[model samples]
Target: MYDFANSGYTTVVITAVFSAYFVGGLAKGAHWATLAWTSALSLSYAIVMLSMPALGAWADLHAGKKRLLMLATIGCVVGTALLAWTPRLSGTEAVIAAMLFIVVSNTFYSYGESLIASFLPELATAQGMGKVSGWGWSFGYVGGMLALGISLGYVLWSQAQGLPASHFVPVCMLITAGIYAVAAAVTFSLLPERAQPRVDRGIGAWQQLRSTWQGARRYRDFVWLLACTVCYQGGVAVAITLAAIYAEQVIGFKPQETMVLIFVLNLAAAGGAFTFGYVQDRLGHRLALSITLVAWMAVCLIAASVTTKGGFWVAAAIAGLAMGSSQSAGRAMVGVLAPPLQMAEFFGLWSFATRLAAIIGPLAYGLVTWATHGNQRVAILATTVLFIAGLLLLLPIDMKRGRAAAIEKSPA
Candidate 1:
């Protein structure tokens, strides 16, 4: 249900509505608009990477993952709502304000996302982790659909009434923040806190970071997993961050058409996550993840090759299938291989790896687009190499060794 809360923030604000608004509406006259938006996102993700390890350590030390989760959620909700005020500003002021608010909102949102995943190990056995993770991820996409549906409905109605984007888009921001707040409220009310304060070690976040680094080689596969995650998830970040823009630029989609395209992605991704959960159990996590990577490569190839809107839609659906399944598999893999006492900290490292990927991926695309004079096709096509590198990295991991290492106690 926490997934239900947060997906709205990502779907409406990051994926569907707000990114394009930041580029086209807020920074309308700038040649560097796309780079500016992507740079803002990269900066925010860098903040998360720098902060999450310590935050995760604090959550574990005080048994405050839920408490921290609440704070992050509230921070994201407020910052997102604050974005509604950006439409009222003009020129560089509007652009600067929007970018600042995005940094605030996105940082909190990313923190909440990582903190929530720390609970997966407590909720399910190792054997059932994949299925449970998949189910949760699948439901998140449903939440994305619900949020996007209402936002899209409002947008269509406002368009019919001849309302401009400056009017309707602010309302969309309010709607996104509202759903995130309400859904997270439900999560806080119902979810039980299971992690007890660590009485054995009273170290600070920096000490925890030092200890984790010292013993990193002991959990060999986990380190390799992080490397793999960085490569593959970089590609996923590009897909998520740039999809709407790609559709509008390459396929001649209007803003409405882009929203509809993402709406379809939510539906398709929900199915993919649910279906792949069972497949992961039957086929093994590595195989399931490999299948998704292969699918992602196909998606890039197909997307790059397509000129017509119909072909693009097909590529988008394929992307949805690969996106949800790979993310679910990766999270489950982390749960399976993290030490029990250090779940939050290890997942924080997981978040760190993903956050790094988030920075690298969007920035790479942005730089390419800027260099190419707005040629996004070559930029997106280049992302395929990240996935290929990730797949090759996956070959060296031995899950049995990793699981054994995870179950043993960490050193004093």
Candidate 2:
């Protein structure tokens, strides 16, 4: 539910409709403001990486993880709804408000994600964690698709009636917030809270967080998984951040066409997520991830070469498939490698790895576009290298043994 909530907001407000509205209508109608907006967003992600582990440690000490997640979601939803009023800002006001939105929303998302590792035990056995992760991802994509469809419907209706394009902004923001509220409610109602830890004065909060970091470093497989996640996840991040923009620029897709492509891709993603989850349960995480990586490599290559709308949709479909399988299996893999009593702490660090890289990926692609006079094919090629590298690095990890290690640490 958290994943669904976040995706609805991310797809509609952050990545698709509202961003376009902000770039064109807000910030006094300056498109260059997008760079500042994106930079501020990156800073938001950096803050999440820096603070989530500390927050996790505090939560562990106080048994307030669920409470914190609820607070974060409230903040995110409020900020998203408040975007309707942000169109009036200019100069520093515009930049600051945008930053606040990014920070609040992403902070909530990162915290919520930390709690997901807790679900691993209830949702799947060690052997079935991949499928469980896939189900979550599939739901996320479905949520995004639903939100995007609403946005597209609004766009088409407004256009047919000769209404302004920016008219959809407030509607999108409200829908995003509304969906997030639902997700949060569902999460609070359905998910079990982690038990409070006994007071142990042996380690200070900071000391415990440091110990978690040290443990991550000391665990060779964990370190390897982090490295793979950082690289390949960056590719996924960049692809998503730019896919629609690229389609618009390269294939001349209208918003309606773009939404269709997104829908098809996400549907494929949903299928791949569930299918790969089952595959991982049977064949294992390493194999499922390996398949996803290879599939992503092909998509990246195809995206680089393809120019037609048909070709773009094909690439999107492939990307969708890779997105679901890889992310779901990866989360499951992380669950299998995490310390049971410290799942939230470990997930916090893991979030830092993947989410921090997400900040880098888009900026890198934007810089590449600027340097090459809007050339993006090269960027696609470079991302493919990251995916391939991740696959190669993951090849050596023994998934069966990793699952055993996690099960051994879990409370019996």
Candidate 3:
């Protein structure tokens, strides 16, 4: 169900549909709207991260974990429903509305993730944390692939019938939202309740926040892992967010062509998630992550130079492989390294790091696009450095060893 939401909500609509629509149609002439939307989205991520630990602590203290998840998921579903009306706005109204949707939707997404993490056990040892996370990602790709394919068929069928192009946009948004709402309901029904933290004699939110910060500093490698995550994750976000627009603007793909390309990418990503997650369970997260980053670097370089839709399609498939594998393996690594009872708090901070990149990656993309006079390829080329830098930072950290160390040092 989480995977369902991930694919339909995050990948299809946020990254592919509305993002492309906004850039290619809504404010085509005013690139600043794209810039503002990306910037605000990133900032919202930081805000969520900064506050998530406190919120997680509060949930623990209040013994209201499931209730919080319900609230966050509801907000995301409602906000996504509102996205159906996004195209109807114009000028400043469009920009503001898009930004609001992205921020609010993302906030709901991140908080819900923290809630889920609260349930993962503190120990599994050799199996690693990759399996579950990878399952979510793999199925997410499947869901996204299904949604994109259906939406694409609808658009192409409508076009063949000489129907208006604009009609498909609202329909896609509504479908994405409805499917997500259904998934949320399914998740609530099937997922088990998380074990609430035992009351800490007198621990308050501030104390938990301080302890989380201090505990984080005790593990020096955790900070470096976060740095790597920020860089690579930023690259991923920037690539996913802008790929549709880039294909439309630079690669000269029409709407139907773009949808097909995105569908292919999702298919490739689904394969990557399943394969790499299984492999990482045996091969180790560090190696798995490093391999994916290297692949991403190569993909970015080729994408930057590619001009034709064929070449872009090939590059998108390659990027999808990297995207799926990294997300699955990376979260597993985080789950391994995080403190035993502080999983939610740790994952919350990890979310912040990824979202932090969300801020930097998109703003950088927007800034480069603006500075280069709408040459999106240049912006893409610059993001290749993020991949290389991240791989380099990840080289020294042994994820297996890190997880062992985290486990050994955990309080009973």
List the candidates' TM-scores in order: 0.98, 0.92, 0.94
Candidate 2, overall lDDT? 0.74
Inter-residue clash pairs, candidate 1 = none
In candidate 3, stretches whose alpha carbon ends up further than 4 angstroms from where it belongs are 61-63, 122-126, 409-412
What is the C-alpha lDDT profile of model 2 across 1-412, one tens digit per residue? Answer: 7778777776776666665555445654343444555565677678878887777677667666778888878877888888766655666686567667766776666667666555565557676787778888888888888888887787788889887654566777787788888876988898777566645666656788887666653466777888888888878877666676677666787766766777777788889998888998898678878888899999988989987878877888888888888878888888888766666666777888887777777667767666676677886777787787888889778765665665564567
- Can you give the lDDT of residue 278 in candidate 3? 84
**Model 3: per-residue Cα lDDT over 98-191, one tens digit each:** 7788788878877886676655544244375677777777888888877777777778778888976457877777777777777778878977
Error of 3 at 282 (Å): 1.6
Better of 1 and 2 by lDDT: 1
Determine the backbone clash count of candidate 3: 0
Better of 2 and 3 by lDDT: 3
Model 1 spans with C-alpha error above 4 angstroms: 410-412
Worst 10 residues of 2 by lDDT: 28-37
Worst 10 residues of 1 by lDDT: 196-205
Q: Looking at candidate 3, what is the lDDT of residue 174?
A: 74
lDDT ranking, best first? 1, 3, 2
Ranking by TM-score: 1, 3, 2
The per-residue C-alpha lDDT of model 1 at residue 252 equals 85
Candidate 1 vs 3: which has more lDDT: 1
